[model samples]
Target: MAISLGLFSSLLSPRETSTLTFTKPSPSSSALRMVRTVTSSTVSHSGPSKIRGIMKPRKVSPEMAALVGAHEISRTQVLKLIWAYIKDNNLQDPEDKRTINCDEKLKKVFQGKDRVGMLEVARLISPHFLKSES
Candidate 1:
């Protein structure tokens, strides 16, 4: 099952020897389709689209700005600052840690609700963040 092209090895350079090791490609339909898909995706794609979401900074309400200490900030940062504020002020209900006792500062941001559930923070804060039309 072997054919000898006698001493042809002596004729090839190191580079040509490596190149000769691989069989010539005759890609099947699926292989070609995969190559096409990969090639299409590797092409460049860039724009402002990458920066248009909750991660993007947006203007905040006056109450929110005062609490977050910034006129404009991202939703993620706002959440972090709000949680920090709650922790610093010891605002969590002792009996049920899931409940938040809104202080005067938090009351303004939370629509004057004296009590807010932990999970409801995000929903209540949604109104404080102005609609961003990006």
Candidate 2:
């Protein structure tokens, strides 16, 4: 004899197989829950409630000072200033616009490199800056 399975079968007997039911979470509820969790985690991990000290400007080296003409500046500003100088002096290579032909001042910054790519300009100029350690 064959037995037919029905939805009510499980509810009728203790030995009956259990059926799983899943309900999707509402979008708004899910979003609110996520926001709450993230906010709590951020609050817990946040080190200080308020900033403790004023930011001090980084010191500039003599070589970098001559290049940047400033006592202290951000790395980004230094790059922009160097590019401005290069443009003003017409240091870009005439043959290939992508190449930079260093002048006397730029040569010092570039470690005597006669030619460099535009991409390398930032890296070469960084050495001229005086870091606290060196």
Candidate 3:
């Protein structure tokens, strides 16, 4: 069966309708029925939960700090912030979005390359992520 992501997403929202029912083992036993209602207010508002070995913060290299500023950031957050910076500066090629043009600041992170392909970005940024300290 084919699943439509849009349909699935709509159905999974906390506001979506759903019901749960359970019968007591013994009516005279005074067993109580427990029910938890689903609603936006009942859902967790916290940010992403920690994954044991993932999302660890790494020291930012001096070169990269010049662009995104000096701070400890997770690899995922670093990539996201870099992409935001690139978009804010309109550094992506107009004709080919996959090609990122390096500005003066970005040139430092990209190791002075005038332009780099989207696939090469991760490899270029890898060195900037320092090994996590125990």
* Predictions in order: lDDT: 0.77, 0.65, 0.75
TM-scores for all candidates: the values are: 0.63, 0.53, 0.59
**Lowest summed lDDT window (length 10), candidate 1:** 32-41
By TM-score, how accurate is candidate 3? 0.59
How many residue pairs clash (N, CA or C atoms closer than 3 angstroms) in each of the candidate models, in the order given?
A: 0, 0, 0
In terms of lDDT, which candidate is stronger, 1 or 2?
1
Winner by lDDT between candidate 3 and candidate 1? 1
How many angstroms is residue 76 displaced in model 2 relative to the true structure, after the best TM-score fit?
Answer: 0.7
- Scored against the true structure, residue 35 in model 2 reaches a CA lDDT of 13
- In model 2, where is the ten-residue run with the lowest total lDDT? 32-41
Model 3 RMSD, rounded to 1 decimal: 13.0
User: RMSDs, each prediction?
Assistant: 13.0, 14.5, 13.0
Clashing pairs in 1: none
The lDDT ranking, best first, is: 1, 3, 2
Instruction: Count clashing residue pairs in model 1.
Output: 0
* Candidate 3 clash figure, as a count: 0
Candidate 1 residues 42-127, lDDT tens each? 33446545676788888899999999999899999999999999999999999999999999999999999999999999998888
